[model samples]
Target: MAPAPRAQPSPVAVAADVSSAPVSTGCGNGGPTTHRGLAAATAASRTMYWPLLRNAECRHGLPAGLLDALVFQESRYRPLVVSRAGAGGLAQLMPRTAGDLGVINRFDAVANLDGGARYLRSMLDRYRSVPLALAAYNAGRGAVDRWGGLPLNRETPDYVRKVLTFFNEDA
Candidate 1:
């Protein structure tokens, strides 16, 4: 009888094995190194403008991470983005809403974030829940009030879910 043929590794298997291996940073100065440190550094770098975020949070008594997550979800932290509906900046505030929030410069990153955070906090207070506040934030407070909290619309429900998911994950 012929000897059994040896099994050959599949390309997918080989690729997966290689990908499972730890990547080397190749930093010659290696004073200290850790995956946790690298992850922390990456997260920190993403929030290098944290002082501005913190200021907004402090001024409005809202959680900084929540504000950051909302801004990221709304505009990906872009200070100059405008929605077709006339929402502007990092928090995507409407011009009238920005005026109501006393945001002097709706296009300014700090001012926009501050106004958005304050507005969200007020909505939270009004609705008494994050999900409801998120729904109001996405859909309008009138819609939420009409529904006695979160709107019954599918789009608003999904938007609230996404915002809360991001907020929880980031926190």
Candidate 2:
């Protein structure tokens, strides 16, 4: 018997006009960092960036909600986020990687999503496995090459699981 089809979640429209919605850092301990606050922020971000996310998904032939899950894991849709490793924007792209991906302004939401999606597509093409591709995205292509599969490292495996879980749940 065949498996049942997955139902994709419809994009929820924000009550406030998207153009006027405030952009939150989606991180840090400062401000209203409660669970509800974070959920609200994530929802707002989903609405605000739905168009860009969908565009990236279509352009890169990525499974629906995959980029959204990655974005949620990376920066929670914060356009101004900078990681401790110097990764920035909604996709948490490192400076070198962003430049290599032709993303001049990593802080720009659209460009960041495009670059991240492109990078993920490359990984998927190379590895031909969602878990392996996600592992490479979280760690690096070099690491995936070194391990020749999903690395046994703690963070990479955990990251892959979380992203996949989110991706499946969002479906």
Across 1-171, the per-residue lDDT of candidate 2 in tens digits comes to 765333222121111221232222222222211233348778787678877877776677776667877898899888898989899999899999998999999998889999999998888778766777777888898877766566667687778777876776754
RMSD of 1: 17.8
> Mind giving the per-residue lDDT tens digits that candidate 1 earns over 11-88?
211222212222222212222212222356444433554567656766666643567667766776667889988999
RMSD of 2: 12.6
Mark the regions of model 1 whose C-alpha exceeds 4 Å error after superposition: 1-46
Report clash pairs, candidate 2.
Answer: none
Every model's Cα RMSD, please?
17.8, 12.6
lDDT of 2: 0.72
Q: Which stretch of 10 consecutive residues in model 2 shows the poorest summed lDDT?
A: 9-18
Estimate TM-scores for all models: 0.69, 0.77
